[model samples]
Target: MPRKGMRSLFFSPKVSTSTDSSTSSSISYFPSPSRFGFSPSKPSFSESVMNRTLEMAEPIIMKWNPETTTFAKVTSLFYDNRKEAIVFIKWVKNLQKAMQLFITGNSSSEKLVRAQNLMQIAMKRLQKEFYQILSMNRAHLDPESVSTRSSSTSFLSSISDYGEEDDDEDTRIVNESITEVEDASSIAMADLKLIADCMISCGYAKECLKIYTIIRKSIVDEGIYKLGVEKFSASQVHKMDWNALELRINHWLNAVRTAVKTLFNGERILSDHVFASSDSIRESCFTVITKEGAIILFGFPENVAKNSKKSPEKVFRILDMYTGISNHWPEIDSIFSFDSTTNIKSQALTSLVRLGEYVRTALNAFESEIQKDSSKLHVAGAEIHILTTDVMNYLSILSDYSNILSDILADSPPPANNSVTESYFGFTDSDDSPAPPITRKIAWLILVLLCKLDAKARYYKDVSFSYLFLANNLQYVVEKVRTSNLKYLLGDEWLSKHDSKVQQFATNYERLGWSHVTNTLPEDPTAVRTPEQVKEIFKKFNSSFDQAYRKQSVCVVLDSKLRDAIKVRLARKIFRGYQKFYNAHGVAMQRDRNSAAVVRFAPEDVGHRLSDLFFGTVDSGSGSHSSFDPSSSHSRRP
Candidate 1:
């Protein structure tokens, strides 16, 4: 007979007896009951055989009870006898059929609740069995502890004159203990996998997830718990079925992704609250998920794609916060009691160096993450170029802070009895001594900013704008370094390189800005000249100069020294050409009374006007040559 409580167990025949003789003759061809068990009677062999067949099939019908049947019971039976391979295989088949029927008969919610309960129970039972196995194996697993207890007990027994000893018996006991531990460990590992499978078969994905979470947590906790008590290998933790764990992790990753989406809200700028919340979530993932598990479950391609899709605005916002914090580093020093020391100045400088180093490290990490897989970043359309430029801008701002810090250090008094020169300048220090911490940090900041600048320049659609932007930032950085103590740390090589870069920018600017004005100057003074031609040259010069001044004046040059140098260069180019033209032709121009009015600028007048070019106060009519004779040698441009 089929097992009790099995609803779908046996197949019953669908044949009916009939009163007609022909029907009975056809039915006789069916298997007789005598074949099953009953002996044929002398009066009627066929009737005896039929009775026995009916009796044999009745038990199958009586045993099936749908109301009393359950998948839980079937699973329990299978696990109880799971150590016997043949019995375990048969029970597993029975449980599978029972689950199918249960699923088909119930609603989805009901099925889920039932499956969840069954899985939870199975996991609990499996855990109990595992502990039991571990207990059985403890003798070999912790032989030292076992032997110590045995020694104490035997010592007491020996004092009482009741101790017994045999070398062969002790050896046998040790070998048997080792064999038992091996068997128990194998059985526990196998049972762990079986329980995991049952959870999967029951369609309890959440329950499976919980079980795996527990396993991972337990592994971590076990190590912590036994840190000094015993040594544990990572392989022991990894002994759980990886394939099953991976499957569950994949499902959990989708949930995590969904949660992350809701947290970000598809927004470019993340608020402080959002940032805090996301950080918490990230910490949770790191806690629960192993690196290998994350790699397999999250996949590098998808993670890279997701990260690349993040808005550049978010990156900028983070950088801005970092800059703001760095700017108030002095305040942080006071709040953190760094100013309490006798060497507060050095402490402040050290703190500033640390802040700069942190910013550089963070920027590098950001760049590395974004550009890890360039192809994916590109495919996802990340604004890597913009991010790079923004990072450079942040560093450029920090370089200004470095200047302020350097000034503070320089103004600070030397220690008692120490020479101001020696202490402030480190003059007495060895030539091979390492650079001051602040100087090295500032050097690193400059290098990283320049590197990012080079990278960002490549993606500019307008190469001229790229050059202009780079020139603006690089000039600012170099000037800051040169004017401050950072110059000593960066050395003369970096200074020369940067100075050349500035000159290149100036050359580009001159070619683009002054070409038309220079082209209008006449090549020869003795050549026959028309007043119309000379007057037209002056007109063109005024127009071009005004246009160039208006455009280039708005361009940023933060350093006063650099700005003054630029103005000097502009004055030289404009006045040198104007002075020559005036010298060669001023006498001829004086031949007409209207020529004085026509000549818009004398050389000295141009020199005076050039001072205001970058100062943004140049007036269009400020350089009029009224009340001045261009023919006087004293009137030549300074």
Candidate 2:
């Protein structure tokens, strides 16, 4: 048989005459110069073992001429050794080529079968090498390291150079000292690719891919578990108390970033690199490894949005989840770009959509809460309303997340029937374009609060106090917007417009609050009056001025600047008229004891009394002989 001829040639080394079992067992085949039909020659001691080693490995490709064989002869060394593994891979490639040669040349069917058997043996060895390299080099061939290692030009260039060089040269590169951490990683990756290339080439791709997906899938699953991402049904999430749910959302916030940036990303790179030779395998491997974890990771926010109680407070956490997904969209798109993994991307996008929906719903509920506020309790002293404080605080915090809200509110159209909202938001005949949706939404919420405050202002008995209440509450809203991120969302133009409204309300309050006192003086204070007219005018002025001062001194303006401004305006209106009247009549009235009693206050006293107004203090000064002292009132905060 042809096998007997090959076996006899391997053990018949002429120089190995000593038949000691140990010495004979050490002999290996090495190809000689004359073996390919050039010239027959005997081997020396040094060359004898090498010749025998070559002859032993030659049986697999015996029909093919050795002179033209492109690969190194397969050695008896174990496939586990790095140098021998490199040589083994070379021999597998030669076996493939020899099988092709026999099939093409119409060689003996028995030889073809033998070559097929040899190919299966080579594939089995490669399968073992592939699994061992993946298992033993977990740290060195980690997905993160392997992903980065695939991009190393030095390692890739070394591999390219290995393709052109002899077996010994390739082995030398593999056997070199691994100086860097990635050096060993690159070597492991190279080994994996080599075995994968051989196995897949021999039609054992299913077996190759099965081993890969099983190991890598477990790693990806464990990674998600380590990151604290767990799959939750809608009911499960809905049943969780807000505090527990909040903590889970916080964990998801951190986990999503790491999963997208490092875990799934690293797996993607590793899968693509390991199966670089096959597009289908690359996609299939990455999809299987990452899809399940990614779907669960991204689906969490959707579950929270859909099933959790629609409390207004929960919207903030939903927005936070929306932000987590929106921030990492680029990596999600790139890592899960495969068609097979489109569901992962869809799941993430669904989370964003659902979160946006929750925000819109919560905002509607917030608006309804504002509308339904039925408490008619008057704010004593016309101070800022509780509704004003609550709403402004809410809007101010909402404005802090304007960028996220912008996206969420992008598709929300403004109320179509309300011309007031349209005009307020700058939709005009000249430019009919709508404001940004977030701008409209935020501005609209504020408009609703103002409408509610306007209704509340009507609860005051005096029209003057009503105006003062509006001024106070509106000023609070303006100040809140000015000091917080809301200022940026509602532009300076909106602020300037609202600021003018506050001043107008303040003006209305001052005029109405003190008009009766100013009206008691003559239209022209210089007009000469008889003693009777002067006495009657003084009598009327005393009653009205005392009443106005007493009433207004108890009312409050909380802001110091607005308080001072209102006081200054009141002084100008009252002092200009009363000072003229007192100068016109005081000379005559002072001469009579009865008339001087009626002329209770001089111009200086009037000015001093006006200064004392708006401190929210009860006036203790009797109108009789008390000079208006600046320091008489308590300095308590209003």
Candidate 3:
């Protein structure tokens, strides 16, 4: 879900002098920052100078304001005032772009705030104009007829036999007109919705987020619909149960329906020919994800030995998610790549699983090491951040995908009518309704939200993303040694010893781990080996090796003569180390002894002495870092 980088990085050079016949003015976009002398090192962001520029531009904007001008003042005044609304909106948008261009590299937060205020004022005015037009179809009705209709309605022949009801009637007409205006404004929301959609479609992600925020706040605060509050909340949601999830889905559908009828009641009937439908591309995506999740859940490696357990159970769930996406939302597919079409629906669904999977694999060794030190777990935000960041990559990619999808959609044919295409699972602004109001915004809003959300998620789960995350200064030192990058740092003198130690460590661990890898190797040498076949062989080896060791231990225990003959290894070592230390230091040393420390020839001789440790009395080299379990810690002693 990365940006395809199809458009030029800077927008100025790409700006065409040729005017778009459809638009009010020729508003060509900047192609790349090179045209403006901006680049990575020199970003197009200026706080002080930007503010001054914006301040300077505000008066120019005010000067350009055409709010007071009537339809007659418009160049093509004979056109519907609604059509004029489009032109005026375009002009306002041009002013906004001009302000953005001026503010680049020169804007401060305060200046940005001012810019928002100006944009909001423009939106509010457009909202007002749209409202007025919709009310009583004032665009078509002249002042004289409007006046006559108003007077006749006011003079009710049956009402006042004594005097004129002019004042009351006029007041009623005004109130009715205002109410009509207000109601029509909601129906016309599509025009505004289109603006928001265009803002997002045009790469103004932050502004899109901000405008969506405003829409949510306006509607939610107004308490127009319970479902709307839920839809807005649901669309951006991170986690929720199935019931709540379904509730959110239902709420959105209902809100779209209700808003279409109540907020924008219109004389026009919805056309059957209109192809407003969610595409197979989206629903198929959900299906793929679902199968991916199922596959991961079905086949993930399980923790057979708590003694050697690596990550927590929760991580498996996460891994399953990664698997799900890997299978469903593969990086490259024949028909399409998930590189496109990352909308709110995709982000919410994809991120959760992506995060879960990355966390499962990111810190493989640490989870196993922690089994011996289970008593305490102090989490830090950095750990969660690592997991979040891993998953966030996908979401980020998904976002990029959305942008691509938008571009694709721009080129796509309209939706086709089909009885099968009855439902949309994710989100829709309005299934069948008139348009609404207009607003504009810039791109920083989404970035800020992403930064904050990332900050919060990381703060809570401060686990190391990997061993590398915890290495501090030592990691670079180790990496240099490993990759032969720091021959100078480690020095040539230690190379022999370093190689020897690493080799020796590898050999011994290999021996210990071989039982895990080779036990299930096909005894029939002719057997073919697929990847899955090899994997199963390894798991079988681990399982069989475990069984073999248990059988050997059982046989020794059952033979009484050998069992009695066996000398206690722990008793000798403890006494030797204890006596040596005590005699040398001239102090009595209390050698810590659990049942495992004292060898037992009989199974019943020493049973369940240290119940808390994984290795029983066996101490993992990590010492305090491990969780204590009684049965597993056999490494500690006799």
Candidate 4:
């Protein structure tokens, strides 16, 4: 007779009875149990029955040694004979109970030592099985596959559907094969969880976690490498040229997305599922696998921001990196939420801060470069300056990243100087309709350039060319703003204000470009004159108009619209003004015999010559000189 506790302690399998070998061992251990008890109905009978139970379970426990038959060759233990595996786990528990009973009774015998040895054998077999399952099913148990376990059917169906689009036999077979692999992946996941649960329950979790984390960590590291992520130091990044750095940035942009969305996220999910038995293990395993690689991955941007040489053009790439992190911040936070992995989160955030700082530094340097451009090299034809072209092109490309710049420049104040703020050009700098930082920042940069252009225009000796210089450069700036993403950022109000300035510059150029010609004629065109007076007036007009045409012909106005408008204004003022005076004087001059020498050009010839004025000297065949210095002194402000 057995005690109730002893009867309850015996290992039982719902699916199958004990094997024949286990039965024979039970018979062999029957007499040994009675030797421990004084009578059949003894109070210590439960302890005796437990001792017998361990001995009977020995054959099943040691049946599959890791050294002889590996789990890779055989089917999964839980899948092949779950009942036997369950019985084996029960035997492990019973062995612990038997060891405790022997120690309590102060009877450490051969049975106790045997139970201890059998326990070690069971653990070794389970550890081997765990490692084999993980290793053999590496591809199937990949983090991506494990992550999709919850949606395996839909994922497989999508694969099948994609393959069906080709309508080929090979595709069909490949789809079926993928479906089978997905099925196997599901089984593999369940099997990993089962083995994990068993080893952890038996106090062998260290061995299990060791194997799991090592394999999984290598997979994650490989994933990062394959994505083109590398451990880059600040110095290494600093030494690279902009073009080379730009390529690395692009690679990081692609790699970071896949790393966050798939690699770390999948690892997080897989770790949590595999170690569902323990929260600490889940977090530990995930942290071990992803922390180092994630920090390096995120730290690349920080290194670039900190170490790379600052340039206005380099800001766009930094913004791209910032956007990559910003776009996936939610996933990154969720995946790396564990306290153990908080450094990864902190590193990512630090990269954002560093990138923002770098962008601002580069922008300030750009403004400084514009301000420091002291080259006295006057641009030929008073056309768009190189500074204007480079600055506007930089700003236009910068405008494309306005959304990110807005965030980075949120706290950055506009230029404080009153000259660039609202004076001179009448930039719309009202406090009431406050612009965003990026808009104000861009406006300030333009104003700085405008101020710089004002200085550059002074290099021209002729005040008319100075005004033309301002008009040409300003027109180019306005066009850049209108065509690019800057159009939306600067707004129509900003464009309108600048357009008026351009018109003002044009008016000044029209007034000054041919001032000599206009001022030569009388105010009242129909005034009477003697033949001598009329011929003298005609001689002065011819001299002034010829000088003006020769000088203005070589000057360039690149914009067709601006060029036409200037020509029209000059035609109205100079052509019409001279025509009235010429009409008044021609009859008197024609009566004189010296009319042909005096009245050298008619009004129609003057009008036709105005057409050739603004097309540059190169086009007009007016000598190779693009610009000339006039002796007449005029204020540079024009």
RMSD of each: 26.8, 9.3, 32.0, 9.2
- Tally clashing residue pairs in candidate 3: 65
Where in model 2 is the C-alpha error above 4 Å? 1-81, 103-125, 136-154, 157-164, 171-187, 375-378, 414-419, 422-431, 528-542, 579-638
Tens digit of per-residue lDDT, candidate 3, span 350-432: 44444533453433332333222222212311111233233333323333223222322233333353221222111122337
The lDDT per prediction is 0.42, 0.73, 0.31, 0.75
The global Cα lDDT (0 to 1) of model 3 is 0.31
**Candidate 4 to truth, TM:** 0.78
Q: Scored by Cα lDDT, where does model 1 land?
A: 0.42
| Top of the candidates by TM-score | 4
Model 1 misplacement above 4 A: 1-363, 366-448, 451-469, 483-485, 590-597, 622-638
TM-score of each: 0.31, 0.77, 0.17, 0.78
lDDT by residue (tens digit), candidate 2, 1-638 = 14454345335544553689777555545455455977646543323333444343445333222233433223222333556556666666645544554465445565566567666666765665677777777787666675555456244434422433467788677656233323667766666676676677667888999888888888889888888889998779979999999989988988988888878888887776677778898899889888888888999999999998787777787888898899999989998888999899999999899899999999999999998898665455687778888888888888888999999988886666557765565332123665678888888888888888888888878888889989988999989989999888877877888888899999999888888887888888667458888888888988998888877766777676677788777767777777788878787789888778998888877877776565456554732222223434332211
lDDT of 4 at 420: 52
